[model samples]
Target: MRRREFVALTLPSVLVMFGFMLVPLYRTVEWSFERVSYGQAGTFVGLQNYLAALTEPRFGRAVVFTVGLTLVVTVVTICLGYLIATLVNGLGRMRPLVLGILLVSYVIPHVVGAVSFSWLFDSNFGGVANFLLGRLTGGDVLWFTDLWPNRLIIALNVIWSMLPFVMLMILAGLQGVSRETLEAAQIDGAGTLGRHWHVIIPSIRGVLGFAVLISTMDVLRTFDNLIPLAPQAVGLGNESIMLYIYNVAFREGAEDLGLGSAISVLTILIILVLLYPSIRSILKEAKEA
Candidate 1:
């Protein structure tokens, strides 16, 4: 392609990215170093917001909660997704129907799915899950208001929503596995577990790594689901990083824009750190290819 044609083809997307992403990112970074508010000029306050965010107890808890949730959700979803994908891949005629069923949660909007998911546990809504569990255990479980129970529900909701996408990715990877290699492994007396551990998983490492990266990033920015699912997040110490930022910057009576911006910057750094290994492996693979 000619340079002129290449530039013309890419110019529109480049401009859009600059206008939508870079502009907001620049403003956020600028605001992080100042005492800021909406629609008003900010006073310069270098490093003060950063220092305050670092020192805040709530911020510390939010970090711990968000990071822990990300780790747990990423691991669980990858394992479960791989297993489900393996089973689904073996199906002949029912694969489409099964996939459609699994994808219902993923296609629903996060807030709507969360509201529906919450009703399954909220006794006020005649929660079937809570009622069944109560009957089984002979006790009522508080899914909300309590710290651990609330966390469990939130994690479950996240896993439920994200599992489909991970499964689809792994299923796509499974399609590319070498049948000849599997046959050879079987001939070598490799059992089902041994074949998967030695042959299939290694073949799809890239797909699994990509799934983990995307899932980690999504879980780290968890906010919409929590809105309907974790109303008492602040009180229960279940506040995610994004929720904490929302409370500080945009919530009524807490317009600490600078602090929120600082936290956002810190969060981007944390995500980059968490994703470094996966990103490096991708780059290395691309270079080799």
Candidate 2:
């Protein structure tokens, strides 16, 4: 393709994305600087809003929650993905069946998947946890009734939702591992664990790093599942950065667009900061590996 034609052909998508998405992202930065109310006009707040926002206890708790969730999700998803991909890679016939089941989740609507998973762990009737509690403890267990359990359920639900993506990515990475390298490890009498830890992992380290960064970013913005199944027996009151931002944007009379925009700008910054090292390391490795 000629350079001119290529630019002309791709110009529309560039326009659409910049107009619809990038414009709002910039506007958030603009709003973050001004003292804007939901429906009322206001003046420039300068850095005053930013200063106040950083000092808020809610912001601190939200940061703690977001960081904690991201850390847990990243570790769990990547580990599960590696293990599942290893099993699938070994199985000849089982690979396709197992992969198909997981791939179907990628296409499912987030809301539908969230609701379905919620029901599976529902406190009412015969959810899996209830059934297990009935069998093991002779009583029902209320997962959402306590803070730790409730947060754990939400985090686990995110893991369930995100695990398949990680698996698919790692499977692609695993496919890139040469048969020769694997054979070399086997020929050297390296056992399965040894081969995996030394040979297989280093070979696909770049993709694994990318997966961790992507999973962490996804966890940072996790709101879809938390929204429908929120403020239950435990309480979902502005628990995470994204959730807190949503509360500031739409909740009753306290809606502050400027504040919401500030939170969003900060959230984007946080994700970027967390992603930088892994992404940079991955790029460096790709250049060298």
Candidate 3:
């Protein structure tokens, strides 16, 4: 294709992005400079929002919570996904059925999952967790009250919503693991666990890196289920940064635009920093391996 034709084909996307995303984003930066609603709107104050966001306890806690949730959920999803993929891959005829179940879970609406999770963790009698409590812990426990429980529920929800995709990717990676390679390894005296620990894992590192990148980015930005799941928790001033931004933009009261913009910019930076290394390593390994 000619350069001009290539440009023509790409022009519409470029134009749409500039018109919709860039224009509004630029205005958001402009808005962040002025004191708006958190106090009175006033003349430009360079870096005030950034400074305020840095100093604010709620924003600090939210940043910590957001990163922590991303870390916890990403680890859980990866581990669980790898385990599930391992189990399904060896199941022969059962593999397709298992994969189908995973697909259904993946396709379920988030709100529906949220409702299910709510029922499962209902502190009162007969919820699954509560029902099991008597058998294990001597009594039922409130799953959402304390800090660890709240975080656990949120992480579990994230892991549940996220695991199917992770598992699917892992399964794909497993499929790519050639049978000849496995047979060769087995002939060399590699046991099942040894093959997994060395051969399978090394072979799929790139896939895992890509999966981690996608999961971390998505999990960091997730808000809907998280917010509803932990509504009563003191603003850690958002359950996550996304939730914080939502509250700043659309909450019934206290819509502070500047703070939200500052936070949004910070959020973008946080994601970039988190993803840059994983992406770089993935590309590097793809080149090497």
Best by TM-score: 1
lDDT per residue as tens, model 1, 54-116: 999999999999999999999999999999999999998998999999999999998899999
lDDT of 3 by residue, 1-289 (tens): 9999999999999999999999998877877787676445556888998999899887778788988888988998899899999998879887778788887757887767866787778755347876777679796555666677778788888888899999989989988877788889999999989989878998999899889989989988888676557776563233788887877666878787887888888877777887788678789999998
Prediction 3 TM-score vs. true: 0.88
Model 3 error, position 235 (Å): 5.4
Q: Where's the lowest-lDDT run of ten residues in candidate 1?
A: 273-282
**How displaced is residue 247 in candidate 3, in Å?**
2.2
Clashing pairs in 1: none
* TM-score of decoy 2: 0.89
Per lDDT, the best of the predicted structures is 1
Candidate ordering by TM-score (highest first): 1, 2, 3
lDDT of 1: 0.96
Task: Write one digit per residue (lDDT tens) for candidate 2, span 1-289.
Answer: 8999999999999999999999988878888988887556668989877887899878887888778988998999899999998888888877778888987767787767778777776866358866776889897555666677678778888888899999989999999998998899899999999999999999999899889878877888888877655556214433777778877777788778888888888777877888788678779999997
Candidate 2: segments with Cα more than 4 A from true spot:
1-3, 232-238, 275-289
Q: Which residue segments of model 1 deviate by more than 4 Å?
A: 275-289
